[model samples]
Target: MRYVIIGASAAGCQAAETLRRYAPGDSITLISDEFRPLYSRPLLTYLLSGEVSPDRIWLKEKDYFNRWGFTPLLGEAVVRVAPQSREVYLASKKAIPYDRLLIASGARPRLPGVPGEDLEGVYTLRNLADWQRLEAGLEGVRAVAVVGAGAVGLKAADALARRGLQVTLLARGAQPLSRVLDATAASMLMQAVGAMGIDLQRYSWPVAIRGEGGKIKSLALNHDRELPVQAALFSVGVTANVEFLEGTGLDDPGGIVVDGSLRSADPHIYAAGDCVQPHHLLTGEQWPYHIWPAAVDQGRVAGANLAGAGLRYRGLLPQNSLSLRGLKIISGGLGPHDAEDCQVMTELDERRGRYRRLVYREGRLVGLTLVGDTENAGIYMQIMAQQLPVQDLAADCRGPDFHPGLLWG
Candidate 1:
């Protein structure tokens, strides 16, 4: 079997490893637009915080490439895909015929159409190159404005703050982490961020960027609020790198569309990760979860199926947990559907800056938001995933007695 995988990120690496194990003698080709080896995207923030080093960022070092007997093509762009023929054409005008192809191109930073957006000193911390740019620009940088208040943006801002750069975080939404965190939980997070001395500008849209000498100087939010920024970082969002499949049979929210088997509409093509819209087990909706876990899981499923073992993807239950500055924050699952008879409970201790809430749907834990009491978060999430009825869940939410034993029916 000849295995061809594009976009050498988490999904690609896992799929390649699996292919090597299941079909040892098969030929495999891994393509990546970036020259750097596959590194963990989530670790970039920690890398910036000096918590992790670059050598440790890679998923596999130089030895893994040689050991697996796979072809590694880096610094090459995939220009086109012919799914009908099961061929991938590269920017270098080389075409590779694949018995099976995996499209894991993943996502790239969304570039806004605002004027002067292409100016220098504006970085998006999506990959290692962006991280190095931000690090290089940090010298003598006093003020920085970060666009988008999503988790990655907040984490990037936190890192910048630790580096002593005065950060101003701008969000088009009314609050921080509105998508992931509930309104009440977001309010508590904002309060904690305020104590960090970081300036937050919510409910604003950036219209244009101003630059002098090809370097960013300032940006006007809707052409009214203009702020001087030594450098700007935009984490607006990500769009999948699917332009190469324009004429191919693969489809996407921005990348390729696939079925439960990770098979695209074309039987010979499979896709996973940020580019492909994988199913969510909770919602039964097919959309790019764009998180680490989903990518890894989908990649493994796709890998097994590629190696001649038919394995159906089980999807994922979108979960993301991380801390900003010094505040511990976590949110997961869909909260109670109509708060009536929902057995909702919340406890807040303002003095200690701790808050916890658990909302149930039909006696099953559906959503949970906790700050400071995270020791039992994983169990609550697992219970929520199984839709198990918690006898004392409401009472536990009312107070801080979240011992795992009490989580039973």
Candidate 2:
């Protein structure tokens, strides 16, 4: 079997590795638009702040693909995928035929349609190339503005502040991390962010970026306010890089729709990671799980199935964990929209800056959020994943005594 994988990030790399084990003699081709080898995308923020060295950012060891016996086509972009002929055409006008293909093109940073976005000093932290370009532009920068208050934007703010740059974080939402954290938890996080000396701007979005000499100079906000900054980093959100599969006849609504086995409409073409939307076991609603761990799991399952190992992906739930300015936050499962039929329990200890919220649907734990103290987060996630009854263990779900032995036994 000749395996061809597109995009060469976490999902594509993991799938290639797993495919090698299952089909030892099969030839594998890993295509990437990046010339650099696989590296930890999450560590890009650390790299920005000089917290980690470039040598330490690589996800795989040197000569990984050479040892694994796969062809690495670096610095090549996949232009189109033709399912009819089982061929993938690259930007170089070369078409490679494959018996099986995995599209893990991943996500690209979504920038607002504001003016001056193409200025020299504005950057998005999606890949190593982005980091390199931003680093080269930051030589004389004194202050920076980060757009959006999502996890990526917050991390960028922290890194910029650590580098002694004045950072102003702007969020269009009412509060920071509003999607994952409830009002109570968001308040606590906002307080922590403020204490770190970073200017937090809520309900504010850049209307237009003003630049001088082809470099960013300031951002004009909604309130007729102009914030001066030498550089700007936008982390608003990401869209799947699925433009290449447009005419392939595979389902693409925001992302490629996949079945439980991560297979697309064409059985031979499978997809995973941020580029594909997999169904939820509980809701049967298809959505993209862009988290790193979920991408790895999806890649493994897709790889196994491609190797004829008929494995079914159980399902995936939304989960996130992050530490910012000494505050640790963890969230899982449902959010506010699906709380109509759920019982909500909250605990707030403002003095200690800790908050916890748990939601139960039909006496089973459906979602959880914890801030400051996330020690027992694993227990909550385990219970939710297994759909264990938490009505009887109410105290455990509400308070600190989360003993898993009672449920397992």
Candidate 3:
């Protein structure tokens, strides 16, 4: 049997490994647009800051595909996926036949629509090649503007700041990470990020990107405030890369829709990673969990089922973890804007810059946010995942020694 998987990122790599272990005799073909072996995507910011070399970013050995006994098709882009013919067409005009297929194409960075967006110094970070390109273009660059206030943009701003470059971060909203962290927690994070010498510009929405001689020169925010910038990065978010599945009969409103087993409507085709959205375990509503851990789990489940193991994926739970200038933040489950019936309990220690909050609905823990100290984040996530009754601990959940083992008893 021939098993084909597109992409070679976290999800694709995990699925290939699982298939190799489960069906040792099956022929596995791993196709990727990247020529390099699998590497850690989270460490790209560290690479940008010069804290880690390019060699340190690799998560696998040089000859990982050869050792795993799979055909490596690196630097090949999939142009079309014909579900009826059970074949994938590549840009090189080659067709690969497969009995089972996994579409883990992942996502690409989303850049806002503004004038001069296609300027020479405007770039987005999504892959290793993008990092190398951006790095190469940073020569003699003194000031830069990072558009967006999400994790990606903030990390980029921090890395630029660490390199002694003046960075101005623009956020459309009032605070950074407004989607995940509440107002108070966001304020705490803003304070720490500001201390890093980053110019935090809240409520600044880009109207146009002005350039001179086809190079970025300044960015106009709201038609008035113009900031000089030599380079700019658009890190607002990412969109699913499922354009190849346009006529493949897959339900892709914005992402590929998959069932519990990570299988698409077509039985032989499966999908995982950011390109697909799964049902939420708690609400049974379909939502996309674009985080790294969920993608790995989805890949494993997809591969196991493709190997005839008949596994069922639970669901995707939202989670995020970040650090800035010695301050750590971790959050899981629903956010404050998720539901109106939630009861939010919070605690803050200004001196230590620590803050924690718990969201409860009908005496059950639904969400949690921790800043500065996240040692007990695992326990909180476990409780939320299990849907255990946490009314007893809601009042004192922020304590250092809140025994989570009691839930098991």
Candidate 4:
């Protein structure tokens, strides 16, 4: 059997490994648009902050593909996939036939449409290329305007602040990480961000990016405020890289919709990672997880199914872990926004810089958010994943005496 995987990130790489392990005799081809070897995307901010070296970014050894007995197509972008012909067409006009194809092409950073966005010093930190350009552009930059207060934007601001650059974080919402954290949790996080000398502006976004001589000079915000900055970085969101699947009838505006087996409309073609919208484990609603772990798990499942393992993905559980300076945060499952039929419980200790919020639906722990203290995050996630009853242990969940043994008991 011939297997072809598009993308070399977490999802694509894991899928290839699973396929090789399950079907050793099958021919496997791995293609990636990035020229660099597989590396951790989550660590890019650390690299920018000088916390980690470039050598540590690689996910595998130099001869990873050679040792795995797979054909590597680095720096090659897939232009189109002919599902009928069972062939993958590359931008180089090369065609490769495959009995099974997995589209884990992932996503690219979304750019907010604003005037002067094409200015020289404006950037997005999604790929190594973007990081390289931003690194080069930061040579004489003293201050930077970061658009969007999402995880990517916050991380970018944090990294830049670590480099002694004045950072102005612009958010379209009332607080940072509004999608993941409630207002209280967000307020606690903002305190830490404020201490870092980052100007956190709420409910503000770039209306226009003004530049001088083709380089960023200032950013005009919605509230008639203009801030002078040497550069601007955007981290609003991401859009799935599914334009290549345009004619394949598998492309979706949200993401490629896949069944439990990760198979798309065409049975011969499968998709995983950020490019595919899998079902949510808790709500049974389909949405893209976009997180690294989700992509890896989806890829493994897709690859197993490709090898005829007949596995069904259980769906995704929303989970995220983030650190701002010394403050740590871990969130999973649903939030207060999904509180229509849910019970919300919260405990806050502003003096100690700790907070915990738990959401319950029909006596089952459905969602959680922990800040400053994340002692039992794994246990919490396990209970949420298994949909275990937590009504009896509800009182103890917010206390320090909470233990995993209690759950099993």
Best by lDDT: 4
Q: How do the predictions measure up, each by TM-score?
A: 0.93, 0.95, 0.96, 0.97
Cα deviation of 363, candidate 4, in Å: 2.7
Q: lDDT (CA) for every model shown?
A: 0.81, 0.86, 0.88, 0.89
At residue 231, candidate 2 shows an lDDT of: 92
Clashing pairs in 1: 251-256, 251-257, 252-255
lDDT of 1 by residue, 1-409 (tens): 7889997888898888887889889899999988866788898988887878888898877676787887989889999998777789999999989999998889889867799888887888888888888788878889998898988988888888877889999989888877777677788888877777789888977799999999888988874889898788899889988888886656454557788999888787888888888776666777676888778888899988888689988666767687875688776775333344555678788777777877766657767778866778888778877767677564644654557558678
Cα misplacement distance, residue 261 of candidate 3 (Å): 0.9
- Candidate achieving higher lDDT, 2 or 3: 3
Per residue, candidate 3 scores C-alpha lDDT tens digits across 273-392 of: 989988876677898768889889898999888898989988888888898769899998888788567877788888888888888777567788999878878988988887877555
List model 4 lDDT by residue over 1-409, tens digit each. Answer: 9999999899999999999999998899999998766899998898899998988899988899989998999989999999889999999999999999999999998888999989999999988888889999999999998998988888889999999999999989889888789989998889999999999999898889999899889999887989999999999888999999888888896799999999999989999999999999999999786899999999999999899999999999999898878989999999668766877878898888999888877767788899998888999899988888665545676676666446543
- lDDT, candidate 3, at 360: 78
For candidate 3, give the lDDT: 0.88
Cα error of candidate 4 at position 21, Å: 1.5
Candidate 3 residue pairs in backbone clash: none
What ranges in model 1 sit over 4 Å off? 335-343, 387-392
Model 2 misplaced regions, further than 4 Å: 251-253, 396-409
- The sequence of per-residue lDDT tens digits that candidate 2 reaches over residues 332-356 is 9898667778778787877777788
By descending TM-score, how would the candidates be arranged? Answer: 4, 3, 2, 1
